[model samples]
Target: MTDPVHIVCPHCEAVNRLARERLNDTPVCGKCAKELFVGAPIDVNTARFNKHIERNDIPVLVDFWAEWCGPCKMMAPAYLQAARRLEPRVRLLKVDTEHLQDLAARYNIRSIPTLALFRNGREVARQPGAMDVNGIVSWVDALMRHA
Candidate 1:
Protein backbone atom coordinates (compact mmCIF):
# COMPACT_ATOMS: atom_id res chain seq x y z
CA MET A 1 0.00 0.00 0.00
CA THR A 2 1.13 3.53 -0.69
CA ASP A 3 1.64 5.97 2.08
CA PRO A 4 -1.00 8.62 2.48
CA VAL A 5 -0.08 12.23 1.87
CA HIS A 6 -0.54 14.43 4.88
CA ILE A 7 -1.95 17.92 4.52
CA VAL A 8 -2.10 20.72 7.03
CA CYS A 9 -5.41 22.40 7.41
CA PRO A 10 -5.22 26.14 6.89
CA HIS A 11 -8.30 26.80 9.04
CA CYS A 12 -7.53 24.88 12.24
CA GLU A 13 -3.87 24.05 11.58
CA ALA A 14 -4.57 20.36 11.91
CA VAL A 15 -2.52 17.81 9.99
CA ASN A 16 -4.53 15.12 8.28
CA ARG A 17 -3.44 12.13 6.27
CA LEU A 18 -5.16 11.90 2.93
CA ALA A 19 -4.85 9.20 0.34
CA ARG A 20 -2.51 10.31 -2.42
CA GLU A 21 -4.91 9.14 -5.07
CA ARG A 22 -7.59 11.41 -3.71
CA LEU A 23 -5.51 14.56 -3.81
CA ASN A 24 -7.36 15.97 -6.78
CA ASP A 25 -10.66 15.40 -5.03
CA THR A 26 -11.92 17.59 -2.21
CA PRO A 27 -10.15 16.99 1.11
CA VAL A 28 -11.57 17.91 4.47
CA CYS A 29 -9.66 18.37 7.68
CA GLY A 30 -10.32 15.62 10.20
CA LYS A 31 -10.23 17.96 13.16
CA CYS A 32 -11.86 21.17 11.96
CA ALA A 33 -13.93 19.52 9.26
CA LYS A 34 -13.01 22.29 6.87
CA GLU A 35 -11.94 21.85 3.31
CA LEU A 36 -8.22 21.33 3.28
CA PHE A 37 -7.75 22.77 -0.17
CA VAL A 38 -9.62 26.01 -0.55
CA GLY A 39 -8.68 28.47 -3.23
CA ALA A 40 -8.04 31.38 -0.92
CA PRO A 41 -4.91 33.00 0.31
CA ILE A 42 -3.98 31.84 3.82
CA ASP A 43 -2.41 34.36 6.12
CA VAL A 44 0.79 33.18 7.74
CA ASN A 45 2.97 34.60 10.43
CA THR A 46 6.69 33.91 10.68
CA ALA A 47 6.36 30.50 12.37
CA ARG A 48 3.45 29.03 10.46
CA PHE A 49 4.89 30.38 7.23
CA ASN A 50 7.99 28.26 7.57
CA LYS A 51 6.00 25.17 8.47
CA HIS A 52 3.62 25.43 5.51
CA ILE A 53 6.36 26.02 2.97
CA GLU A 54 8.42 23.13 4.24
CA ARG A 55 5.64 20.59 4.74
CA ASN A 56 3.21 21.05 1.88
CA ASP A 57 3.59 18.89 -1.23
CA ILE A 58 1.75 21.25 -3.50
CA PRO A 59 3.35 24.26 -5.08
CA VAL A 60 3.08 27.30 -2.81
CA LEU A 61 2.93 30.89 -3.94
CA VAL A 62 3.68 33.42 -1.25
CA ASP A 63 3.05 37.10 -1.61
CA PHE A 64 5.39 39.23 0.40
CA TRP A 65 3.77 42.57 1.00
CA ALA A 66 3.46 45.38 3.47
CA GLU A 67 0.34 47.33 4.31
CA TRP A 68 1.92 50.68 3.55
CA CYS A 69 2.75 49.98 -0.06
CA GLY A 70 0.31 51.36 -2.58
CA PRO A 71 0.96 48.68 -5.21
CA CYS A 72 0.62 46.00 -2.61
CA LYS A 73 -2.76 47.29 -1.60
CA MET A 74 -3.85 47.51 -5.21
CA MET A 75 -2.75 43.92 -5.88
CA ALA A 76 -4.45 42.39 -2.88
CA PRO A 77 -7.73 41.79 -4.63
CA ALA A 78 -6.05 40.31 -7.68
CA TYR A 79 -4.06 37.96 -5.50
CA LEU A 80 -7.21 36.85 -3.74
CA GLN A 81 -8.93 36.22 -7.03
CA ALA A 82 -6.08 34.06 -8.22
CA ALA A 83 -6.17 32.14 -5.00
CA ARG A 84 -9.85 31.45 -5.40
CA ARG A 85 -9.32 30.15 -8.91
CA LEU A 86 -6.41 27.87 -8.10
CA GLU A 87 -7.63 26.02 -5.04
CA PRO A 88 -6.65 22.43 -4.24
CA ARG A 89 -4.13 22.38 -7.06
CA VAL A 90 -2.05 25.22 -5.70
CA ARG A 91 -1.67 26.72 -2.26
CA LEU A 92 -1.61 30.48 -1.77
CA LEU A 93 0.04 32.22 1.17
CA LYS A 94 0.63 35.80 2.24
CA VAL A 95 3.46 37.06 4.37
CA ASP A 96 3.44 40.50 5.88
CA THR A 97 6.84 42.04 5.37
CA GLU A 98 6.32 44.30 8.35
CA HIS A 99 5.69 41.45 10.73
CA LEU A 100 8.21 39.06 9.22
CA GLN A 101 11.20 41.18 8.47
CA ASP A 102 13.57 38.28 8.98
CA LEU A 103 11.76 36.21 6.40
CA ALA A 104 11.68 39.08 3.95
CA ALA A 105 15.37 39.69 4.40
CA ARG A 106 16.21 36.03 4.08
CA TYR A 107 14.44 35.93 0.73
CA ASN A 108 16.27 39.14 -0.21
CA ILE A 109 13.06 40.85 -1.04
CA ARG A 110 14.13 44.37 -1.91
CA SER A 111 10.65 45.38 -2.91
CA ILE A 112 7.17 44.99 -1.58
CA PRO A 113 4.53 42.95 -3.43
CA THR A 114 7.02 40.32 -4.42
CA LEU A 115 5.77 36.87 -5.29
CA ALA A 116 7.77 33.75 -4.60
CA LEU A 117 7.05 30.25 -5.78
CA PHE A 118 8.20 27.24 -3.82
CA ARG A 119 8.14 23.56 -4.51
CA ASN A 120 9.25 20.97 -1.98
CA GLY A 121 10.47 23.77 0.27
CA ARG A 122 12.83 25.20 -2.31
CA GLU A 123 12.23 28.52 -4.00
CA VAL A 124 12.20 28.11 -7.74
CA ALA A 125 11.07 31.48 -8.98
CA ARG A 126 10.19 34.96 -7.84
CA GLN A 127 8.93 38.21 -9.28
CA PRO A 128 8.81 41.67 -7.82
CA GLY A 129 5.77 43.95 -7.93
CA ALA A 130 2.05 43.36 -8.19
CA MET A 131 0.54 41.22 -10.90
CA ASP A 132 -2.97 41.00 -12.22
CA VAL A 133 -4.99 37.81 -11.84
CA ASN A 134 -4.26 36.53 -15.32
CA GLY A 135 -0.57 37.30 -15.07
CA ILE A 136 -0.32 35.52 -11.74
CA VAL A 137 -2.16 32.50 -13.07
CA SER A 138 0.04 32.25 -16.14
CA TRP A 139 3.19 32.52 -14.10
CA VAL A 140 2.05 29.84 -11.71
CA ASP A 141 1.02 27.58 -14.54
CA ALA A 142 4.38 27.96 -16.17
CA LEU A 143 6.14 27.19 -12.92
CA MET A 144 4.15 23.99 -12.50
CA ARG A 145 4.84 22.90 -16.04
CA HIS A 146 8.54 23.40 -15.52
CA ALA A 147 8.45 21.54 -12.25
Candidate 2:
Protein backbone atom coordinates (compact mmCIF):
# COMPACT_ATOMS: atom_id res chain seq x y z
CA MET A 1 0.00 0.00 0.00
CA THR A 2 1.09 3.52 -0.68
CA ASP A 3 1.89 5.77 2.21
CA PRO A 4 -0.71 8.23 3.34
CA VAL A 5 0.02 11.88 2.65
CA HIS A 6 -0.84 14.97 4.64
CA ILE A 7 -3.32 17.35 3.09
CA VAL A 8 -4.01 20.79 4.49
CA CYS A 9 -7.66 21.60 4.19
CA PRO A 10 -8.25 24.76 2.22
CA HIS A 11 -11.47 25.48 4.02
CA CYS A 12 -10.58 24.98 7.68
CA GLU A 13 -6.78 24.77 7.56
CA ALA A 14 -7.04 21.38 9.21
CA VAL A 15 -4.54 18.63 8.49
CA ASN A 16 -5.70 15.30 7.10
CA ARG A 17 -3.79 12.08 6.50
CA LEU A 18 -5.08 10.44 3.37
CA ALA A 19 -3.87 7.60 1.22
CA ARG A 20 -2.00 8.84 -1.81
CA GLU A 21 -4.27 6.80 -4.05
CA ARG A 22 -7.40 8.44 -2.69
CA LEU A 23 -6.43 12.00 -3.52
CA ASN A 24 -8.55 12.09 -6.63
CA ASP A 25 -11.56 10.44 -4.98
CA THR A 26 -13.24 13.63 -3.83
CA PRO A 27 -11.79 13.70 -0.37
CA VAL A 28 -13.33 15.81 2.40
CA CYS A 29 -11.81 17.45 5.42
CA GLY A 30 -12.11 15.67 8.76
CA LYS A 31 -12.48 18.95 10.61
CA CYS A 32 -14.77 21.00 8.39
CA ALA A 33 -16.46 18.20 6.42
CA LYS A 34 -15.81 20.27 3.33
CA GLU A 35 -14.30 19.07 0.10
CA LEU A 36 -10.55 19.30 0.23
CA PHE A 37 -10.06 20.09 -3.41
CA VAL A 38 -12.41 22.92 -4.31
CA GLY A 39 -11.24 23.18 -7.93
CA ALA A 40 -10.13 26.74 -7.24
CA PRO A 41 -7.12 28.55 -5.89
CA ILE A 42 -7.35 29.39 -2.21
CA ASP A 43 -6.54 32.99 -1.43
CA VAL A 44 -4.08 32.83 1.41
CA ASN A 45 -2.82 35.37 3.85
CA THR A 46 0.49 35.01 5.63
CA ALA A 47 -0.63 32.60 8.35
CA ARG A 48 -2.63 30.26 6.14
CA PHE A 49 0.02 30.46 3.44
CA ASN A 50 2.74 29.35 5.80
CA LYS A 51 0.61 26.51 7.13
CA HIS A 52 -0.18 25.13 3.72
CA ILE A 53 3.36 25.45 2.43
CA GLU A 54 5.13 24.01 5.44
CA ARG A 55 2.66 21.24 6.23
CA ASN A 56 1.25 19.78 3.06
CA ASP A 57 2.90 16.55 1.86
CA ILE A 58 1.88 17.30 -1.68
CA PRO A 59 3.32 19.94 -3.96
CA VAL A 60 1.98 23.49 -3.90
CA LEU A 61 1.56 25.98 -6.74
CA VAL A 62 1.42 29.61 -5.72
CA ASP A 63 0.47 32.63 -7.75
CA PHE A 64 1.99 35.81 -6.40
CA TRP A 65 0.08 38.78 -7.72
CA ALA A 66 -1.08 42.26 -6.89
CA GLU A 67 -4.50 43.76 -7.57
CA TRP A 68 -3.05 46.54 -9.70
CA CYS A 69 -1.00 44.26 -11.98
CA GLY A 70 -2.52 44.07 -15.40
CA PRO A 71 -0.77 40.82 -16.27
CA CYS A 72 -1.92 39.36 -13.00
CA LYS A 73 -5.49 40.16 -13.89
CA MET A 74 -5.00 38.76 -17.35
CA MET A 75 -3.72 35.48 -16.01
CA ALA A 76 -6.32 35.09 -13.28
CA PRO A 77 -8.70 33.17 -15.48
CA ALA A 78 -5.96 30.89 -16.72
CA TYR A 79 -4.82 30.26 -13.17
CA LEU A 80 -8.41 29.41 -12.23
CA GLN A 81 -8.66 27.00 -15.11
CA ALA A 82 -5.33 25.48 -14.17
CA ALA A 83 -6.64 25.00 -10.66
CA ARG A 84 -9.50 22.91 -11.99
CA ARG A 85 -7.03 20.74 -13.84
CA LEU A 86 -4.33 20.50 -11.16
CA GLU A 87 -6.23 20.15 -7.92
CA PRO A 88 -6.11 16.98 -5.78
CA ARG A 89 -2.51 16.69 -6.99
CA VAL A 90 -1.23 20.18 -6.42
CA ARG A 91 -2.58 22.66 -3.88
CA LEU A 92 -3.15 25.94 -5.74
CA LEU A 93 -2.84 29.16 -3.76
CA LYS A 94 -2.89 32.88 -4.46
CA VAL A 95 -0.99 35.44 -2.42
CA ASP A 96 -1.75 39.08 -2.94
CA THR A 97 1.53 40.96 -2.76
CA GLU A 98 -0.20 44.16 -1.71
CA HIS A 99 -1.61 42.57 1.44
CA LEU A 100 1.30 40.24 2.14
CA GLN A 101 4.33 42.32 1.38
CA ASP A 102 6.45 40.19 3.65
CA LEU A 103 5.68 37.03 1.72
CA ALA A 104 6.42 38.73 -1.56
CA ALA A 105 9.72 39.98 -0.26
CA ARG A 106 10.61 36.63 1.24
CA TYR A 107 10.03 34.91 -2.06
CA ASN A 108 11.89 37.64 -3.93
CA ILE A 109 8.95 38.33 -6.14
CA ARG A 110 10.44 40.98 -8.42
CA SER A 111 7.72 40.49 -11.00
CA ILE A 112 3.98 40.37 -10.81
CA PRO A 113 1.97 37.31 -11.80
CA THR A 114 4.75 35.04 -10.75
CA LEU A 115 4.02 31.34 -10.45
CA ALA A 116 6.10 29.36 -8.01
CA LEU A 117 5.97 25.62 -7.53
CA PHE A 118 7.01 24.24 -4.16
CA ARG A 119 7.78 20.66 -3.32
CA ASN A 120 8.88 19.25 0.01
CA GLY A 121 8.80 22.79 1.40
CA ARG A 122 11.17 24.19 -1.21
CA GLU A 123 10.64 26.05 -4.41
CA VAL A 124 11.35 23.80 -7.38
CA ALA A 125 10.54 26.11 -10.26
CA ARG A 126 9.29 29.60 -10.96
CA GLN A 127 7.70 31.22 -13.98
CA PRO A 128 7.19 34.94 -14.18
CA GLY A 129 4.70 36.09 -16.75
CA ALA A 130 1.12 35.72 -17.90
CA MET A 131 0.13 32.51 -19.55
CA ASP A 132 -2.96 31.02 -21.05
CA VAL A 133 -4.62 27.91 -19.66
CA ASN A 134 -2.71 25.60 -21.95
CA GLY A 135 0.60 27.24 -21.19
CA ILE A 136 -0.03 27.14 -17.49
CA VAL A 137 -0.98 23.48 -17.47
CA SER A 138 1.83 22.47 -19.77
CA TRP A 139 4.45 24.34 -17.80
CA VAL A 140 3.38 22.74 -14.52
CA ASP A 141 3.08 19.30 -16.04
CA ALA A 142 6.52 19.44 -17.55
CA LEU A 143 8.12 20.64 -14.36
CA MET A 144 6.37 18.02 -12.26
CA ARG A 145 7.17 15.19 -14.62
CA HIS A 146 10.86 15.96 -14.64
CA ALA A 147 11.25 17.21 -11.11
Tell me the spans in candidate 1 whose CA falls farther than 4 Å from its real position: 1-3
What would the per-residue lDDT of candidate 2 be over residues 1-147, giving only the tens digit for each residue? 799999999999999999999999999999999999999999999999999999999989999999999999999999999999998889999999999999999999999999999998899999999999999899999998998
What lDDT is obtained when candidate 2 is compared to the true structure?
A: 0.95
Residue 31 of candidate 1: its Cα lDDT?
99
Which digits, one per residue and each the tens of the lDDT, describe model 1 over residues 1-147? Answer: 457776778988776887777877788889989889877899998878887888887788999999999999999999999998877677899999999999999999999899999888899999998899999999999889888
Clash list (residue pairs), candidate 1? none
Q: What TM-score does each of the candidates earn?
A: 0.92, 0.98
Best by lDDT: 2
- The CA root-mean-square deviation of candidate 2, after full C-alpha superposition on the true structure, stands at 0.6
